[model samples]
Target: MNRKRSRGKNPWRCSHRYPLRRRRRATPGRSRGDPAVDPEDPEQDPDDGNAPPSDDDEDDDEAGPVVTTTHRRFDYPPPVPRMPRETLEMLHYDQFWITYVGTRYRHPALPDDWDMTVEISIPDEFGSRQNIHVRHAPTRRNSHEAAISDAAREALTTLCHAHREDMAITSRRYYPCRSVERLDAWIANPEAEQNPRLESTIEYLATLNTDYNAALDELDMVRYENRKLRAWVAHGVEPAEEEPVEDPADAPRRKKARYNDPEARTYIRHHED
Candidate 1:
């Protein structure tokens, strides 16, 4: 009877109203089935609408047009190998005597007299073709001759022993036929001076000779400059100004005056007819 119940109105109602209803969340198994309603789809985002498609999406979209990117790897070749060093061959030679001509003197420090003319062929480890010459003659007294003699004797003994050993070893070892033949020839014919090993040894020694000559040339140049500088300092004169003078006859002569008489030129008078 509150104002006559309408046919469509309900009799029961709440005094305070509840909040607005929220949309039902999508279930784990159920979907809205509408493509436009699917919020998980990337196309639904307005910012991503115009963005470029990812590789995965592009691959999924096309079936025939396969996009493949090829990467090329480069490899560098290894460096070249170096050649090995050659092994040295041993050699033997017969004993030969040599004469030396020089002075002999004795030092106060020496127990015995020293001789400079002692000639001995010492064996070299490098080869038998090489020879070393030693000369010892002290000009002053109280020289270290004893010590030098001891050292020289020890060196000579060692050299001789080593030479014998090397010869024995070489005899047991292999040697080039040509080289041996040349050695035999040299031993047989003393005057026919030709060495088979000479060519190779000379080639090797040429490099050393070139270096030695270069050093000598440099030393000579330095010595010449030093001498020139010393001479200049001693004389207290510049080298550039020391020019030779010409002879008196070759020098230019000055003009001479011509006189009619000897007494007339002694006095010069004013002109009077």
Candidate 2:
């Protein structure tokens, strides 16, 4: 049935307006039945307006205490090392005796110009063992004479060292307490000029110095000859020979002719003819 339209409004407009008003429920985020936020409520989050309240503490309790399985470590000491079986043992002796066992030259034919091997026997080893040392030119290539000098010098050095204490005692005996205020200062006094001990030491040292000087001179000659020979050998040069000595009897003698001689007279007559 057709109803009478309102006087001021259109019929279509009135009908659409009433239905829209009744169909529009609450606005999207807010509804009439939704719970209101209490300002004092502890469980509610002031910042989280959209999310619901949660029971975080109850959930953590339900998960219980965390259990972790760890790996066990085993520690043992390092293996002990064993000593080598092939190691040699050192020979130990309380005392050792040394004895001269003669010298051996490097070259038998040219012994004077060669090195010498001095062998010393170890008496503790029952003379079966010997220590051989090469005695040669100390500074440069010299002669066997220098080698002998070196051996003598070494022997004297050893002898002096061995008898050092004895020599000191002997010196003290010569310069007694009455000699000076102190034994060391005895040589500083003028009276010590006549000291027998000082004289003997001076004489001994002078003799050694003289011998050493002689050896040095000999060694110098040997060194010069050796160097010359080596240089000549390097250049492939033969050594020069000594000149032969002239004999007075081998010279041709001329006899002086006298005017009275027959040969001279015949020569003069031949020339005249």
Q: What is the C-alpha lDDT of each candidate?
A: 0.26, 0.27
Name the best candidate (by TM-score): 2
| lDDT by residue (tens digit), candidate 1, 66-91 | 22211101110111000000011233
- Highest lDDT scorer: 2
RMSD of each: 50.1, 55.9
In the predicted model 2, the residue pairs found to clash are: none
Q: Write the per-residue lDDT of candidate 2 for residues 1-273, one digit (tens) a residue.
A: 975444543322211111111212334774432223323478975443322112221121111111111110011011100000000001122222222111221211122233222222123356333332111122222343344344333332222233334433332222111111111101112234677786666555444444443454456556556644643544434323323424321111112233333321111001100
